[model samples]
Target: MISISETSTQRLRALAAATAAALLLAGCGTAEDDAPTDTDVSASPSAISLPVTPVTIELVDPGAEPRSSLTYEPAGEQSVVLTTSSTVSQQIDDQAAQDFSTPEITLPLTAQAPESDAGGEIRLRIGTPTSADQRLTEALAVAEGSEAGLTVTDTGAVTALSISPNADAEDAARAAIEQALNQAVYRSISFPSEDVGVGAVWTTEQQVVSGLTLNQTTTATLRERDGDRLTIDLRIDQTPESATLELPDDAGQLAIDTYTMSGSGTLEFDLGRSLPVSGEVTVAGEQQYSDPEGTTVLRQDISDTLRWSTP
Candidate 1:
């Protein structure tokens, strides 16, 4: 895996340009505007506590290890060749039945003291890929570079970032890094503004792309809780939005008319310590991309799971 945080600016910029064809994204479940308050709230058999007190919510670093997988499936034959730093790869099989999954990527979740009460900023440091697939490894080569940074709110929204490669980076790479950063922002879980027990649910919706082309929404519910061990049910749904991709030199353009992705999973939180235990979400969606020559479709049904290490 490439150490993007420690990588030279030039290399990081060039790498982003290399992998821009894959930019599918989605989000977790949402919480309602008004969550139940501790004063007047229902209690559950299990005991779970929110960060009502000043506590830090962070991701304990798990030294170089494969964490997540992102796969893309185009609807039709891939006309263009997706070349890594190496040779032109046909891992997907020339527009045949194939789902291209990038190497396992670890969300370098290292942050300073986050004041949950004040909702401070947390800087996430990305590292390298652990996937054995060279194609995927090359495509997702910038997760760990000193040149790349993803600044997110304690609430789990990506406010600002240096993920876009330097001016030397390509349009595709810059755009892709932006997409990846936003998708990965979910790695930081958001806590309820106030204290609540199991059964309390909340919703979150955010606009990812300009003109609202890629809008996403998520719903999170505190399902079962037992002392520090708590189980939260999660359901995430994406808005079905589409747009056409403007091809260069009129080589032909690919526009996505049908696009929607969603995930359903569970999250376990340690209220006593005010930290995340583990979470897993199963996301599945299909998109239709059309160009001059013909139409291309992309579909994905995959599982993304994460378990935070003990401090």
Candidate 2:
């Protein structure tokens, strides 16, 4: 058993190391300080476009017995790889990391699922910023808690994520899962892009350990030229679980085939060309999970609208 303090220490060390490396690499480039290149787009005054991108969630439970660590390693092509490992053992702690943002599930296991030996890694190539990520950057540049459109609190850490918890156990769990997915998309957006003047590029690849075959597609749309405001929309879908958890051969199952997550918001970047961007996120989606029966399961839909902010 590991103490919470110990777990925090280990995580701090890993975060420190990763942050240092990323910063060192970032130092090679000059910072953007001048007035932003404002490309005002005419978007529908009431609509925001969602971006399609995969969001990865690694769970870390700092308790008497530590669960796992979220690690970020540099990959070729200026990309970063994220993986999670259990503090208890060397095996990649999938359940822990995957379930972190969600509530606890105490279902009794009736049948033992076969252990998988498949091992692969997911990579997010950070080349250019996407429209959603860039819009977020602008929103962050001048975001205030009062007008963020979503309720958000800054914990003063390397990341700021939203938590949309559903009151129902399963629903809450699904909300957390959705939040993680959105954050993963956010990570893709976080990477600065040289190709676009004011957006980020997001790419994803899934690696499996044994029997599971996984593939996900994500896309995002950012428009600010409809009426006089900016809107960002994002959507992500995974192939449905099959005998091997591959995309279901049939399309009807496709609805339940892959896990679908999405989010969108209206952003106001008209503040004096300086700080303080405001927006609200109104998003919804379904969460897929394996039940105590080990049968592929799906939870009720989850959605929310809250204020958001960045500083």
Candidate 3:
């Protein structure tokens, strides 16, 4: 396993760019008033807390060893492309798959976005099985898998990002180009997804993350400035839960019982304007299987940030 130091931890602090912050503007309106002066106007930070949720579904195992990474791409007016990749590994009981038709599992993941001007394709492959499903009833039966354990490794990659001339963006493009030159800003962007989607992922709550597994419960508050900017303050947490993987008992695979976990963190964001963000995470989890009942558990606390920009 890889070791983490204070210096490495501070670098991770930059990951907060992934979450944004708040921007408030002051204004006033009056009937028959030709114009308003700053003397008569004042704006306060919005105190309202609206619901917030996650736009993408991610499957993660916090206990796995952290993966090393490299990013490379060309830059210019021609066409730019960016690529990112990370790997994770964990130990699992071999008998866990006895009841299932297959010996594999599936997880939700994210692909990195390339540089804005990079016109490249983004693709995600399991690097193993592309898809698999287990019966809910079968999942509930086995409390644990066999005594023998196996090593599992997984990788996620974002292969491309594209940028192009926008005829209609003459206005927005101009504003972004101007802003990009001076002040640094972080923006939180959201996209609708038909698969692995959440009903309201932007809520405030705590989250628990285990080995490639995540459970979150939260409440979120959000305020929007026209359609351009949004401010959000939220609490998120992840913990392990008792998950049972059931396969046909006749399949001779080990039944598996998952350990439970939980934790919470604060997340703040800026829609169009970027701000520095920081937070912490704590979680615990273990893996076990039926028959001889073997177990593996892990616990950790983490904090990190990344440069973030959204459109």
The whole-model lDDT of each prediction reads: 0.38, 0.25, 0.22
TM agreement with the true structure for every prediction? 0.50, 0.26, 0.25
Query: Which ranges in model 3 have alpha carbons more than 4 Å from their true place?
Result: 1-218, 221-242, 245-258, 273-276, 285-311
**Candidate 1 local lDDT, residue 194:** 45
- lDDT by residue (1-311, candidate 2, tens digit) is 11224443344233322221111111101112111122212321211222232333221212222222211222222111111111111111132221111221111101111122211112121111111234333322221111001111111012222222222223323322333233333323221121221222233332111122224333433333222222433343434334322221221121223344444544433211111134444434443433233332323333433333332
Which parts of model 2 have CA positions greater than 4 angstroms off?
Answer: 1-188, 195-218, 225-233, 236-258, 266-276, 287-298, 309-311
lDDT of 3: 0.22
* Cα lDDT of model 1 by residue, 1-311, tens digit: 22213232233222222212222332211122112223211222111121111223222221122222111111111111111111112111124333334333333333333344434333333344233456544554643342333334434444443332333334433333443443444433455444455566666665443222345566776676565466767676766344664433233344555555666777665533323445655555554444444433323333333334332
Q: Which 10-residue window in model 1 sums to the lowest lDDT?
A: 77-86
Q: Model 3 RMSD to the real structure?
A: 24.6
Per-residue C-alpha lDDT of model 3 across residues 1-311, encoded as one tens digit per residue: 11134442222222111110000000011111212222211221111111112233232211112221111221221211111111112222221211101112221112332345433322211111112234422331221110100111111111111122122223322222212211111112221121111222333222211112234543333322223223333344444343432122122222335433333333333222222122222222333434323332211222212222221
